[model samples]
Target: MLNIEKTFDQITAMGPVHLKIFTYIMQMLRDKYDVSMIDFDIEKSIFFYGIDSLKIIEIHSALEARLNCKIPTEAFFQANTFKGMIDDIVKSISNDGNLGIETSHYSLETEIQEALDYLLRDRPQRDEGYQTELTHTTLLTGASGFVGTFFLKELLENTDLKIFCLVRAADEAAGLERIRKTERKYNAHLPQGWEDRVQIVIGDMSKKRLGLTDEVYQEYAKTIDSVYHVAAVDNFYLPYNIIKKTNVVGTVEVADFALEGKIKPFYHVSSCAVSLLEQCSDPPTIIGLVNGYAQTKYVTEQIILRIAEKGLPWSSFRLGYLYTLGISDVDLDPNVSFKKLLQLVAKAYDKVEDDFFIEADAFENFLMAIPEIGCVPDLDANFDLMPVEYGAKAIIKTSLLPMSELKSCYTFYNPCPLDWSDIVNYFKQSNKRIEKVPLNTFVDKYAEYVRHTDDNSIKLLKSVVSSQLDQQLNTMFRQIDTDMVKEDIHWCPPCEKQFTHAYVDFVLND
Candidate 1:
């Protein structure tokens, strides 16, 4: 039904083992649930399709019987997508009886050390007299990526500098085509005759000389004014080596590039999710970061700090999660952009405008149910959501300002985070059929439904649970010191109701 393993020699990104299991599971889904394999999204909940509770129960039993192993019901609830289910299966089998995350075999500390060595070794004599002056040219990595494309557009609109894009392509023509596709795909409105001012360098971050010949690379070094490092592997589940090679080693390479010739100010887009000290004035560390992506980001920051110690002035933006609503359809490309990464969590929006909207499993239904069962007192935790467009503009504008002015306040997140309980009454007032059950009752229902759930029965339960925990624990909640950064262009926060409506509209229409 869904065996791509035999035909997957052509698909190198997915290894044979994964390909085999995935093909098997997808085939089972098709055969047992009447699911179509065409254009199947691995990140979407099966409930988003026509699959209901009865089919899910049948599928779960069928899979267990066929595989001759215990497949946890929680996995179906937690790993909502088919791809995630495959990963869950792999992890479960690999762990045997153990129930913890898979750890990387390689030394992550070694990966961090290599970045420091690259920046410090065979060091180019510093351009000690280099002054931060008006920009004439700028080098940017990840121009074809989601945030990169937006940042690229920002640079074009705001500055007079000629932009040099470091793109991974076979040749200049290919690079241009890639750029064209990325811009159109993201609806990046490039100004007319924008091509003249932009130059494309065909290169790979993981390779030597940025995958450029020594001669061409040197020519590039001589022409650049600044560096914007935004490209990265954002997958949380990817292996440590893949993350380290790009986020750590590739960072070292970029830092090296910035130092040679006219030493330029390096703009590194880091993440706020990096473990912060319990207090505001505490040192930044990577202790609490759970995934490889966050860990690598932490190491990359450490590398940048080391390079700065070597006399290169740099600016690091501690970016927050981008908003995942009301964007053009082109934003949801298969690549791990903000939109795609947030897909599973956004399933509530996906069902809001459906014909069965009242019958769907929804986020608010769970929240509304929380108080009745007293699982936890009404949670007032802040859950701010910043629109990507506003955040991108703020980031680009802030990056261009003098570091001293904005360095301390380089954070970009919801100026106002949402509180779950605060919004519940509003939903109730609307007289919608968002049922409220006791928390324990809801849990029992969830247990029953994962076996055979349909009718919008909390498809994003895992995400909802995580969010609830985050709120209850105030785990990562920290005040946004927006005053530390200059706001050249003010951001008007969307009203939560209006904001949600727009997102719901996009999901239904799409």
Candidate 2:
């Protein structure tokens, strides 16, 4: 068990700045999370375990306000320990005296550089005679996820190649059950006799060799004809270090495995968020990204680019927001972004007090608070609502392109995007009217609403609103460039109103 008093006493010899940083973070943790460390490592991050990413943002804001200094968001995300984070915060605020130990000195750029070096340290030389066509088998990761579920359905229905799904599970049966669960969630079905075509390989991307034994790893490396990597931590608010093991390092593991035997064509499923920094110079800097998910994807794409430069046949499919899998009906994940937004509206209109809310600083209070306050911010943003089926089909179509003709990257964003005003209008048609107000007015209204509320959900909501007003600004997504996908794949999103209407109707009723 970790002793809080003893740890503070040890740090007391350090300067006041160190003490202030430590005290602020500890107080914020206790107040927001109601956490008192019982058996945690003092040498580990204050965000060790059970601490949500939103809590990190809260601590970040409180430390900034207390110290009256701007600490880099990277400092919090990159630090390995609570002590090191305090040390960095102290250095940021003060220059006099021995300002504790300066740990995590590298920027996001340096971290990405070092990670790239390590992942590509002992790169294997590619073998000759790469198969341009589908062979006997393909290895797929994230087969149980939203887009991957449709990818699995596509392969099983269309191709003669056997699919080896690399799933993280206790065994083959559990892995199969997870796949079945995803299928049921999407109301998607596999072709008859699908068991004969799909094999489950119990493995984890976070581990070396995908958590496979040496013999099994080598066997798959030699036999698998292609690689389709779709797995990721997929959280926008999490720090880079928290998701690094799975998103970045796991990608490297997959890349290494692809290069081990007869070189396989790697089809990496990246996010359109990589477009956030697409305009950067040859090697994009990680500072331009808003969150860790984008940062990790940016780094992974850089790694894949380097590998592609090394003559590994690779194609990256940068996907937009997969709104739903079965577009015809109400087959959607409850946690999908647009659904959450609609849910907030429904909660607001009905005066429903739901205990469960997706806790993230990026989303925080605004979505739900909109209805409570009876006003919406002029968010001036649009969403690239790509159906999961379209994304899956696009990936498959491009992956099958002749090796010589395939572009290095194919970005899949919806040609017909949904604007914020369109969504507001949709709700109006459904008989829920919300006033569209300026950003400041919305903030003012939210503040007034917070003053009168003492509910648990409102407490969490106020933690963000009262701490930082700028967090209330909508997270604007820039238009993604999909020229490669447009020219090569010749695909467009199904613009039928049925898709949007079904999505809206489903959330409203739920």
Candidate 3:
């Protein structure tokens, strides 16, 4: 093969010019990653299995800088292999120092179409053994996650079924301990004698078949009467490939696993971001989504719809930011939830606007976490909060319904979204220190502030909020009817002003 695994020096056969270009490319890759550890096969694409546009851009810039020459943007995408890149570089310099591709040919739409191709490739077939049955033993992924732990407690307390929790751990014992710790975090103690009924399947969703052996995978698949595929790589800013592996590929593997043996209800815990694709769609296409997390959800949901057409029963719960554990010793370690984020901000604040209800330190943290939310000058946004404790119950109840009764999309958003006006007033009423900070103004200004801010907390908060909340606020949306959600939107309380201060105090004390 022209492209083989070798160090930069091993390519002595190449002309001195080709050798220089190859060395710079390899060096640029090593700058950020341990190239020795990277399974680099020149025969393979610079992007296949690893690498992305960002790294490609980095390499392109480095090559240009080293060669003191310009490279067309399309060359990066076109030169998919090591040899191709070398050939392109040679051709560009030889052919009147110009390449023949335009930047307009490659766009976000093109990239998304490529991703969709990867997501839907090699569709798994329904095994002959596939047979639908009532719930007896359930296979659940993400059992150690924030909402997953609450879900574990719910299943343990409510059902006689044996629960197989697919957790990523070194061993079964380690996985059990992790589950125990998660349960304790939420104060949801494991039930006595529950050890016999709960089996921990140590595995990674980022791997094929949940990183289990075929025998083990198929064995569990045969016994599973229901599958709660809650596991996901939830980072809003993760590179598209990294998140896609878990959220999209892992989902397909789990769904295929469901189709492999004893069939049952497939309940996927997705995010409300899937709707964002449509919200921002100029012509209403899934490609409208920009972030990796939301794009994965949209792709996975589309896959599920296709799977459902084949009579594989499934239901998806498009959840919003969930707040579980109420106010008692409120859980915040996950820090992924919006409520937990507010809790972090609460610590940075000192006092309430009323000048009595909240401490200054608490108020300070709140402002820091949401520096702008603490002093929102405008009131034109909506905050959706679904308490996890109740939300998990709703999932269990809804998933248990007959497949014939389920809808394709079951969004669990607050029926009455808390108005940004009421939210600002709530914080204002709590602390006079808080000022009116317009969300639009705050977002525009803070976008720059976040760039220069050295605080990791602020940076992380910015990354999460910018991708999810910023787009959400800009998009025109209404509280969608939850008639098909199987649970009343009214069943879940909104993020109200009445409990605003109390919530902060509870989070602070915890």
Residues 404-466 of candidate 2: C-alpha lDDT, one tens digit per residue:
888787777776665656555555565456787665676566656654554334433432332
Q: Which ten residues in a row have the lowest lDDT in candidate 3?
A: 355-364
Candidate 3's TM-score: 0.66
Clash pairs for candidate 2: none
Q: Candidate 2: lDDT over CA atoms?
A: 0.65
lDDT by residue for model 1 over 159-191, one digit each (tens)?
998999998888878887777776664455566
**What is the total number of backbone clashes in candidate 3?**
29
Q: What is the per-residue lDDT of model 3 for residues 1-510, given as tens digits with 9 covering 90 to 100? A: 222345344555667777777777777667675564245666566776367654554565556556755554445555657667675676566655455432122233444455445543563544453435455789888888777877776688768888999888888899988887665555454567767888998887767777999899878876677888888876543434456677777887787677665555788887777777554443232121245566677777766665566666777787766665333223334325555556544543322233223222312343455544445546466655566766676777776666677766677766655555665665567678767754556665554554444443343333334323544643523556543333333335556664554554455454
Query: TM-score of each candidate?
Result: 0.64, 0.73, 0.66
Task: Flag regions of model 1 displaced more than 4 Å.
Answer: 1-110, 124-131, 276-289, 309-311, 324-380, 403-409, 422-478, 483-489, 494-510
| lDDT, model 3 | 0.61
By TM-score, rank the candidates, best first.
2, 3, 1
